[model samples]
Target: MKQNLIADYLSCILFRITGFFTCFLPFNISLFMGRRLGDLIYIFDRKHRVVACANIRKTVAEGGDWRAATRITRKAYQAFGQNLIEISFIPRINKPYLEKYINIVNKDNIEAAFKRGKGVIFLAVHAGDWELSNIICANLGFPFILFVRDQGFPRLNRLLNSYRLKQGAKIIYKQAGPRQLIETVNKNQAIGMTMDQGGRHGELVKFFGREASMSTGAVKLALKYDCSIIPTFYTRVKGPYIKVILDQVYTVSRSGEAQKDLRDNLQRLAGIYEKYIRLYPHEYLWTYKIWKYGKERELLILSDGKTGHLRQSESAAKLIIQQLAGRGIKTNLSIQEVRSRESRQGLISFKPDIIISAGSSISALNYRLARQSQAKSIVLMRPSNLSLKKFDLVIIPEHDNPPARKNVVVTSGALNLIDADYLKEKSERLKRSGFIKSALSPLCIGVLIGGNSKGFSISGRLISTVICEIKRSAEELNADILLSTSRRTSPEVEQVIKNELGGYGRCKLLVISNEHNNPDVVGAILGFSSIVISSPESISMVSEAASAGKYVMVF
Candidate 1:
């Protein structure tokens, strides 16, 4: 035990000495060294870098470039340097000097909080010069006692902690527990704590796409003392200035449930960190393994549902992803086995927008596996363990009665992938550019198709009949035949249509996902069809057909 203490003491000492050196170094040189050190860590300390990248990836998912994420990560290292500098210089912060340099927003919030007079629990995160944030609070006539974890260095810890004391911060080591913390704040003194980092027994909270361990001690402390809890942070902006903001204060209320309110209030403070982190995600410190406990974002099981029709659902998700891609949103897709590990791990890894857990076969897995996933859990069937609140969405076909949920986006029939608007717009461009001439006819016969569904294959036999009927219909109306297919139409049927109709000048055909000389055929059909007959295979194609405001026949 003594040897263990000795090692811990030495570790603390080494941290302080090095911290002091970094703090005292010239700002420009320090920044240069900081970034270089970050690069070394990025290359060698792969774990922390992975966390930083994960955090960066979430914000970057919205179109933030990879290079920008890298730049922001290195900036976190530089911010760490500033933290050391601010702490090393803490001794120089007398009340007058402190008053001149420090600024806190929402002073009224602080004053209103202080007026309660029992004490205040000030919550914050290590987002910026957090040590400096405390100095300013101390100088503002608040006897602030900071809850801090001691490093493994003795001399520097003593030196640095002594300086912290000089700035009027009453520091408390973690071992002091609830009694000491209550006492410190009992005499109308404020207790300050940084709540962003994970701890041994912390609860999990959503950060980025995963669960991260977050301490609730500060909230617990405030409730025990019936004091006020306030969250504040000081972020380093351009030049030598810092932007300090004190958020709304929460009073420890016991109107009904005492402990419940406390947890909620602490969570409120944590949200402020998440809010700010998103704004300048690159600026936030992510090098400390922020996602150590987070679950995967999403787990998308790529499977074909036996009952609901396989090719149709697969085509639907693919359609959404394709449309989103056209609009520049992207991730990736994988088979059921590929994303299954995320079920074992948690939510942070999969990072799904929506878990399209295709097929009823995987419904049981969704219950067990989704319980651990980070994303809003989605299952395709009636998820068992119905009491498990983790299941965010249950997408049962409307035909079957499933429990109501806000997370579900049910289709009228089945989902398919097709960009009707993009298709329509492209058709217009082609018409304007004169690639495919649009000519009016006496009778326009539009053919909409689906592949195999619910044991019914829309065969070439059926297509040959439909084609013959359509030709007769067009002949009776003295108009041309306009042939088209849903996204799920088999290539064989499309080939049959081309073979039967290609030589005819008056007939026009649009085929999708088939080997064809023209990819814009589907677009032209939707844009120009006077009357349309669509297949029952894909709801998405029917919907797209409807959206074009064209004449539609859903068979």
Candidate 2:
């Protein structure tokens, strides 16, 4: 608390000093200095600069270009600087000052709204020389009541409010609540309030193709009291000269259902402002997290078309979705099978919060896409060509000898979709398909055969010996066997296994991968078997068996 107070005091002192000089300087010179001040802020304020760029990327750029977002953010900073300096010149905003610098378009709209005998609600967003709006409205002979939230710095807030009060505008604190607002409306006066940055308790509506929380207070009051809502916007025509546009009065829809009516009106109001922001993005405020409390997120998965790698990416995506669900967030999942690095045209417009990929083939694509979209990248297994630091998280097997890094996570084996529910579901499907006989032996042994790997190959003789030993053990223990071959199995070894145990009574299930493939075979084998014998070639296969709690034997 002490630290915050000291910082606030220092900030107030700095603002006062700047204001004193700005008040005496010429309008154009003040604007030039303010722009320089903003440029300095853009260079030094790393935190808000990042926030601004991220906001621009997500909304205006549509997650396409970082350079464009940066340029716009820099200009936005300059505009904000000019706006801050203009606030100090508020005392000079008289009739001649208004005529010289301010141009009010559709000035008759205010008259028409008051002619309705219901109060007027001036709905505005945090955009373009907004501090001078009430003064301009008061100078135009409109009864403007500035309904404002108190700032944390008490002295600064009082200082700013005094300027508004001196311009024939009445003040209504937000905390003073409904009574004064009702009175202001009863007298058919106009109340100015902003609808952006609603904070936690706001209505969720779609803005820039994403759900953003927006304040519904303006819409709610307009609906309940039959007030005319004039969507007001300010644009800097040039240095120190602004155009105040009073948009067409919003026609409130009365559906009699309060909640639906409130949301629909708010969405329409947001749409009006979004259109303007798209046209003049540099004039709008982009320093805050626009979607911070948003409840929706998009997840993109880049697949290499290999079964093992795709499954690992899917597993990671599943865990992420679960975690997001716990936070009351909904996730939209999209899978892109990347055949080549150039196969990324479809992902250009997708704005994802996270991008997940596995296998070396898609790692480069993942890195590039994450950089383009500004999403967090997660890679499974150590990427062959890319540095580990490139990804936000790296999941590697312990056998790979992963380095000790903050982003590196070494797991015991490869990731797989093996769980009790998954096993049970696959097992039931296999049983229903008549792959598992009812009269089968109670004890079951599963055999998983994989083919060649780096510097390793399975010979036909080795398979013959393995099958003979398995036959002898099955006869002694009265156990049934479930066997499946991988897609990489050699034809010589596959034929040897068929000749050895094809029609044997103990060998109830035999799947030849080249002839036909059953997606559920492996999971079903792990689901029912007590002992599992797997070739040492595949880490993914062995990991799946061990994860199922089966006694695994490697040959």
Q: Pick the candidate with the highest TM-score.
A: 2
Q: Highest lDDT among the candidates is held by which one?
A: 2
lDDT of each: 0.62, 0.87
**In model 1, what lDDT does residue 246 have?**
81
Off by over 4 Å in 1: 1-44, 59-61, 95-100, 151-156, 208-210, 252-255, 294-297, 300-555
lDDT of 2 by residue, 288-349 (tens): 87877789989998887766677788888999999999999999999888786466666666
Q: Candidates' TM-scores?
A: 0.51, 0.82
Question: Where does model 2 exceed 4 Å of error?
Answer: 23-26, 304-306, 344-346, 358-415, 424-446, 449-521, 524-531, 537-539, 549-551
Query: How does model 1 score by TM-score?
Result: 0.51
Clash count of each predicted structure: 29, 0
Candidate 1 C-alpha lDDT tens digits along 345-463: 34333444445555555556555443322233555444554542456655555655554667665655444334566656756765665444357564565566667766667888778
Cα misplacement distance, residue 345 of candidate 2 (Å): 5.4
Error of 2 at 328 (Å): 3.7
